[model samples]
Target: MKDMLIDDFQYTAQELLIRNKSILDLITKYQDSNSRVNRAIIKAVTQCGCMTISAHKQEIPDDASLDEMKTSVESHIEGLLCENCRDAIERDIGRNVFYLASICNALDLNLYDIILKENDRIRMLGKYNLR
Candidate 1:
C-alpha cells in the first residue's frame, strides 16, 4: 500500500494557493456580495483553534454544544481579527507556528522527543498545555 503520510507531499505557500485556486476564485467571485465569505473564513479559523486545543487534550467535543463552540469561536475570531483582514490572519498564523517551533528547539524538544513525551504524558498524567 502507498504510504498514507503527509510527508510524501511538499508545497510552498504559493503552491498551496495555486492548488486551491477554487477558493481564491470563490473569494474573488463573492467579494462584492457582502463580507459573508470573509466572515466564514474567520469563523473557520477560530473553529480550527478550538478543535486543535480540544484534540491535543483528547477531549471529545459535545455535539449538542457545538453552538456554544461556534459562539466562542466567533468571539475569538472577532478579538484576534478585526475588519476581516486575511493578510493579517495569514501572517499571524505563520509567525505563531514559527515561534512555536523556535520554542521547541530552544527547549531541546525535537519531533521524536516531543511525540514520545506527549505519548507518555497522555498515558500517565494527561494532556495539558505545553507551557
Candidate 2:
C-alpha cells in the first residue's frame, strides 16, 4: 500500500541516517539536498538543453475567479525532461526526501503523519489554500 511505503521509507531513512543525527546536521543536510535538487534541474535547462524556463509575471484580471487564476497560471517550464535529466532529478529529489525524513526522525516527528495532515489541510482548504 502507498501508506505502508511512506512509513517504510521514513523508518528506513531513520535507520540509515548515521552521521547526521543532530538537529543542526540534519537541517544542513536537508538544505544541501535541496540545493542538489535545484542544481539538477538547472543542469537539465543549462547543460543538457532539455528544458527551458520561460517565466514572466502573471497578471490576473480583477474579474477572474480563483479557479480561473489557477488554470491560467503557467508553470513556465517549456519541455519535458529527457531520460538522463529525469533520472538525475529523481535521484536528487530522493536524496531530498531522505534528508527530510532524517530531520523528522531527529525531531521525533512522523513524516507520514505530517504528509497526511498536509493532504487533509489541502483538501479542507481547497482553492482557499493560496500557498
Candidate 3:
C-alpha cells in the first residue's frame, strides 16, 4: 500500500516514455513541465481572472513561536480556481510528476523509496526539519 502510487507511477512513466529516454531529454522535459505548471497558474490569474496573488512582505514577529508564524503567514492568493483553470493546473502538475518519475527511472532510483526516506527524515526532524 505504501509504495502503490509512487511505484505504479514510476513504472507507468518508464513504460510510456518512448520519446524521452535520454537523461538530458528527461531533465529538460521536467523543466518544461515545471514551466507549464507556472504558466497554468499565471493564466488562472491573468487570463481567467479566477484568482489573484497579492504579494507583500510577511510581518511575523521576531519572538513569535512556530505555531504563531504558521498562523500569521499568508499565501496572499485570493479567490478559487475556476473549473477550467483547475483542470489545466492539474494536468500540468500531472505532467510534472510524470517527468519526475521518468527521471528517477532513468537513474535507477525508486520513487517510492525516495518519498519514504524523505517522509522519515521529515518525521524524525519534526519542527526543526524545515530549516
Among these predictions, the greatest lDDT belongs to 3
User: Order the candidates by lDDT, highest first — what do you get?
Assistant: 3, 2, 1
Q: What's model 2's lDDT at 38?
A: 99
Cα lDDT of model 1 by residue, 41-108, tens digit: 55545653321112223333577364454443322222243444555556555544433333344344
Q: Against the true structure, whose TM-score is highest?
A: 2
Task: For each candidate in the order shown, give its overall lDDT on alpha carbons.
Answer: 0.41, 0.92, 0.94
lDDT of 2 by residue, 1-131 (tens): 88899889999998898877889998998899899999999999999989999999987878999999998888899999999999999999999999998888888898889999999999999999998
Worst 10 residues of 2 by lDDT: 14-23
Query: Which stretch of 10 consecutive residues in model 3 shows the poorest summed lDDT?
Result: 122-131
lDDT of 2: 0.92
Candidate 3 local lDDT, 1-131, one digit each (tens): 75897788899999999998999999999999999999999999999999999989999999999888888989989999999999999999999999999999999999899988998999999877755
Better of 1 and 2 by TM-score: 2
**Model 3 misplaced stretches (Cα beyond 4 Å):** none
Q: Which ten residues in a row have the lowest lDDT in candidate 1?
A: 1-10
Alpha carbon deviation, residue 14, candidate 3 (Å): 0.5
